[model samples]
Target: MLKIEDLHVAVDGAEILKGLTLEVPAGEVHAIMGPNGSGKSTLSHTIAGRDAYEVLSGGVTLDGDNLLALDPNERAAKGLFLSFQHPIEIPGVQTMNFIRTAMNAQRKARSEEEISAADFLKSIRAKAKLVGLNDAKIKRPFNVGFSGGEKKRMEMLQLVMFEPRFAIMDETDSGLDIDALKMVGDVVNELRDPSRGFLVITHYQRLLDYIKPDAVHVLADGRIVKSGGPELAAELERSGYDQFIEAA
Candidate 1:
């Protein structure tokens, strides 16, 4: 399980996540929705152990491990993955080489053997097809010359290839069309299992229509004010965040 107990975080000496607490158990997907500046990104970054976000108080744990104590790479090696809101472009690095290096680094951290080139190529090819990326795209530099939607697809590609125990997808649907949205849902659904969990952060209810979450939480002013089932997403879509914004 991934648990956050009264998580208090600050960025640039200003508090963003205030007394935020939540839990996502294994085998379920949870969605977080909020207006601008509600600390949605902060929560994800804090859990992922980003250095700029300072944890003033409270705790975050995966299963039983103290996540806050680990560095970002340590957290990743522990099966924590965060799909960034803006995927970066690495100009000089080869896509396959970067991924393989990262995969091996994580494995090495866990005392596991590295993947062979043949096996890695086979796996990447299969997952690339699943994420709707052709061989040519995979061969290109990471996120170089790709559109916004394609960048999101690249994120999904890593999500599937890594198969982390818990994933935080931060606004992955921002620039995707219906087809890309469905492809995102397809990859997520295929990876959903009893031992894994997801925290999907999105603005629109359309993505929820594709991958229905077990629970949805409303975040406002750095705290979760209300939580409900999948129906809450539709309600939010209709009512909007005006009421919640005032409440915050």
Candidate 2:
């Protein structure tokens, strides 16, 4: 389980996540819907151990392990993954090499043997196709010259390749079209399992049409003010965030 109890995080001198508390159990996908500046991204960043998103007080745990105590890479080694809201481009890095190195590093940290080159190539090729990336695209440097939708696909490619225990997808649907959205959903659904969990953050309910979260939470002013089943997303889409904004 991924648990956050009264997490308080500040970016710069201003607090963004104000006493936010949330829990995502294993084997379920939870969607967080909120307005702009509601701290949705902050919660994801803080959980992923991003720098400058200072945790003033509170606790975060992944299956009883204290997450706040671990460094970002250490957290990744612990089966935590965050798909960035805006994936960046690394000009000098080879996409395939970077991902393989990361996977091997995680395996090494867990006292497991490194994956063979043959196995990695096979897996990456399969996952790449699933995410709609061609061989030439994967052969390119990470995200360099790729379109916005392609970058999101690259993120999905990483998500599937890593197959982390917990995944926090921060606004992955932001720039994706219908086909891309379905592709994202396909990758996630393929990776979904009893031991894995997902926290999907988004502003629109359209993405839910594909991923179909197990539960939906309303995040306002850095706190989860309300929660419900998948229907909650539809409600937010119909009534909009005005009510939740006032309640927050």
Candidate 3:
């Protein structure tokens, strides 16, 4: 389970996540909906242990392991993945090489044998197809010269390939079209299992139409102001976040 207990975080001396608390139990997918600057990305980055997102107080734990103490790479080795809202472009790194290196590094940290070249090739090709990415795209530099939708596809490809125990998708639906959104849902649903968990941070209800989160949370002023079943997303869509924002 991923649990947050009164987490207060600051970035560059300004607090973004203030006394936020939430839990994503294993086998569940939870969605977070909030207006801009509500600390949705802040929560994700803090969980992933990014630099300068200082944890002023509170705690975050994954299956009883204190996540606050671990570095970002250590967290990745422990099966935590964060799909960035804006996938950056690496000018010179080959896509396949970078992913393979990262996969092997995580395996090495876990004391597992590295995947052989042939096996890695086969797996990446299969997952690329699954996420609507083609062989040509995968052969290019990572996210370089790719459209926003293509970058999102690359993120989904990694999600499917890594099969992380817990995933925090920060507004992955931001720049995607209907087809790309459905592809994201398809990859997530295929990976859904009794042992994996997802924290999907999104602004729209359409993405939820495909993924169907078990719970929907309303975040305002860096805190979860309201939480409900999947229907809450629709309610938020109809009513908007004004009420929740005021309440918060």
**lDDT for each candidate structure:** 0.95, 0.94, 0.94
112-218, model 3: which lDDT tens digit per residue?
99999999999999989988889999999999999999999999988887889999999999988999999999889999999999999999899999999999999
Write model 2 residue lDDT over 115-226, tens digit each, in one string: 9999999999998998999999888999999999999999999999998999999999999999999998888888899999999999999999999899999999888999
User: Clashing residue pairs, candidate 3?
Assistant: none
Which stretches in model 3 have alpha-carbon errors above 4 Å?
A: none
Weakest lDDT window of 10 consecutive positions for candidate 1:
91-100
Count of clashes, each model = 0, 0, 0
Q: How far is candidate 1 from the true structure (C-alpha RMSD, Å)?
A: 0.6
The root-mean-square deviation over C-alpha atoms between each candidate and the true structure, in angstroms, is 0.6, 0.7, 0.6
Clashing pairs in 2: none
Q: Per-candidate TM vs. native?
A: 0.99, 0.98, 0.99
